[model samples]
Target: MELQLQIKMNPKLYLRDPEQSPLGRNIIQHSILMIQKIGFEDFTFKKLAVEVGTTEASIYRYFENKHKLLTYVIAWFWTWLEYQLLYHTNNVKSPKEKIQVVIRLLAFQLPDQFTFSHIDRNRLYEIAITEGSKSYLTKHVTQDNKDHFFKPYKDLCARIAEIFREYNPSYKYPRSLSSTLLEMAHYQFFFKKNLPGLTDFANAKDDAGVVQFLQHLVFSALKKGS
Candidate 1:
């Protein structure tokens, strides 16, 4: 794997830094694979410890619980995504073109060459699409927010929201639209795959059609008339 970049995720999500040592890295790498294979609901530290050749006590040294680990992985993802967005869009001049770029990046399939550390970019996307909501949609969300466990995601949203304002200063729902577009990218794909009746691209095997649909939805709303 290529050493392209390192994302410094929010520290509050973990007990010991997973990037600090080989054991920590192994924990993160294998946890991602396990969560993707077993689903988060069925995943447990005991199982993860067995997979990583470590004891449950050792795993607990890094993360408070499985939920914290989940949030850490997802937070790392958000930071990685924000980096990609800035790297790709740094030179683009127009806000309209920039926002368009953002939509495509968010909704597109994982490129085979993209990666960070030893983690599989493809599996990470799968986890994000299916399990990302669990990171925040919980009774603990209030306390998590207070701890800033969600800062990376919020930061990513804020960056896109700024572009929305740049595109149309008078638009009243820049933040709402920004967050909606982000969620829509994931939800639409999930709906298309699992609940055909919920989306127009029911039979679509890829995100190409959904990307076009998002472009229409966003630009149409940004248009002065509607």
Candidate 2:
């Protein structure tokens, strides 16, 4: 039997949970592709409807608007990522080594060992690195934050922060550093790809350099009292 993973999502982000029905699944599956191809600015229900072979109303039945839909998918990614971080680190004994695993998970795609069933993990990752911030960087962010739209992201950071504490309980900025590591992973990769001039890996265009840089920064910070 092929076991699949299901990440529970925030209900406020959607009118109906898309995981419950086929049309809802289609909406999510195609939205990632369309968003990756055309981006959030150009993506719309009408276009997504055409892509998914459904009406705009059908898509709206699951999501309140494109922004909420985007949040839904991005939150899904963070939740799944948290699972990946924990699952991969569960047996590891060393806190530093566990965090190293977390960095690698954030930096690279895994060989597809299990079927995800509905969503394309690559498309979703691309959309996340590119459009993930748009989900929260809005005028309504304060209200959205109050409603816990960003919980999965915060949860992921919190998990990392806990690990950081295990490595160095005296570290006062664990949460800040945890969130910084998460954002740095995406920004460095983005720089490596498009804005190469902004990154040191312009010549090599290597994910390994990003991993090394992150390792240096993380371990350097956790090096007890500098």
Q: State which candidate has the highest TM-score.
A: 2
TM-score of each: 0.93, 0.95
Cα deviation at 188, candidate 1, in Å, is 0.9
- Candidate 1 backbone collisions, by pair: none
1-226 per-residue lDDT for model 1 (tens digits): 4336767767778889989999999999999999989999999999999999999999999999999999998988888888778876789999988988898778754343345566876688778989999999999899999999999899999999898888888788878888899899899988987888999998776778999999897887777633
lDDT of 2: 0.88
Q: After superposition, how far is residue 52 of candidate 1 from its true place, in Å?
A: 0.8
> How well does candidate 1 score on lDDT at residue 63?
95
RMSD of 1: 2.0
> What lDDT is reached at residue 214 by model 1?
91
